[model samples]
Target: MNHPPLAGHPADTGLELCEGSALQERGLAVSFDIQLWDHPARAFALRFDGRPVAYVNRCAHVPAEMDWQPDHFLDDSGEWIMCAIHGAIYDPRDGRCAGGPCPGGKLIEVKVDERDGKVYWYPSADVQPAFPD
Candidate 1:
């Protein structure tokens, strides 16, 4: 249940994810390891509309990884997050299920913030850092 220390930010600040420049607009996501309810899992962060968005890599339709290729979440149009397994499309801005299977479902969102040239993802009660500080 331990978390990393926020060196320059507040004690409630999120864990350091990556450099701000690492996420390109509508491009490959920056993947990272996490512990979801004490189980190992993966999460990803990407830039859309000049802002950062993140979500657990699991699709809502099924507890399966959604990326077609490593770090490749967005579809060919680069407008939505598409699951390679069930073909569920999600809005990257909010992780809402937009089309295909799993209607009315939503991806597990991972809160994120960008500041001081870095991106950080918040750890929740259920989601935690894989490697504690």
Candidate 2:
């Protein structure tokens, strides 16, 4: 299904991310990309309470990717998102920093929608689709 542009911004993602098989367990993660601050930036989506939540991959602590490995953002307990660099823990549901160096900080959320068995991401003023380099 095609979605019309929003605020002159086209749909940033397609249905490829709708494959929810990998999200059966909480904390499972998937990675995607978007344009942030006019630069290519990595973002990730994770399963939490059977729902998909996404955020810019940057850690609130020091502006670094949080995953220890590609698409690996969850800790062993599968309860929270973990930053490999500074050990920052973020609430997967809302991206709020729950503990560690990041206090009163939160991950940048990327708007996503799941409908008719498809998943799509929407771009906002601050975050847009990343062009191929």
Candidate 3:
């Protein structure tokens, strides 16, 4: 698969966090629940076997973040990412809705790629491409 070029962006976004990797080798899941855009949009970064994966935190059914707390979006089992508001479960591998209110509903995928071993989001990491009132 093709990934984006990581040029200039913060070390962390709502979607992911740097796990103290100078080369950005690893990424820890982060909660964007704090920064709720008008659209409740949040970006995340994930690294699987050194591959970069970035996606928005918004669910497909309703406009909400997939986190119960800051950087605590994963379930207690740490198996799948979950939405505390509606009990939705998502596969971290593909962001596909595996369970919950909308069984088939999936989280929106945000575009991001890795460059020089670091992850990055497009239009910037704030996810505030359009300011909300």
Candidate 4:
């Protein structure tokens, strides 16, 4: 599983995730691998309300992957992020729990920025790019 480094994107601009056009409003997400707390993990980015958002794919309630289908995180209505397993819903804007088993819980968000027709995710202390910089 070798992933080529994102070409042309400097570290200061963050790691490129996908093309901005790849994410449609409430459409399929663009999934990516990450290193969460030094462990391999999955994350995804999608568009909602005309903006891009991302999160570590783990559910707030059970720490399980939440997409109902691969790259599908939004509920049927395309309004909220629904956990595939336990029905936990989260606001796409800020990853805050909107309803379900995990009251007051929130998704672990991956900071993202969209510019120059591309989407980029920023790594934090707990989250890092899966590939070496």
Q: Model 4 segments beyond 4 Å from truth?
A: 1-11
- Which segments of candidate 1 are over 4 A away from where they belong? 1-11
Q: Please provide, for model 1 over 57-93, each residue's C-alpha lDDT reduced to its tens digit, 9 standing for 90 to 100.
A: 9999999999999999999999999999979999998
Candidate 4 root-mean-square deviation in Å: 4.4
> What is model 3's C-alpha RMSD?
7.6
Best-fitting candidate, scored by TM-score:
1
TM-scores of all predicted structures: 0.90, 0.84, 0.60, 0.89
Clashing pairs in 3: 15-43, 15-44, 15-45
Candidate 2: Cα lDDT at 22: 58
The candidate, 1 or 4, that scores higher on lDDT is: 1
* Candidate with better lDDT, 1 vs 2: 1
Error of 2 at 27 (Å): 4.6
Candidate 1 whole-model C-alpha lDDT, 0 to 1: 0.91
TM-score of 3: 0.60
Residue 98 miss distance in model 2 (angstroms): 0.4
| Full-model lDDT for every candidate | 0.91, 0.77, 0.56, 0.89
Q: What is the C-alpha RMSD of each candidate to the true structure, in Å?
A: 3.1, 4.5, 7.6, 4.4
**Looking at model 1, how many pairs of residues clash?**
0
**Ten contiguous residues minimizing lDDT sum, candidate 3:** 14-23
Give a tens-digit lDDT track for model 3, residues 1-133.
2224334533244223334242232335633322333344566655544555556767666876656765456677666777878888887677788888767776665555555444445443334343335
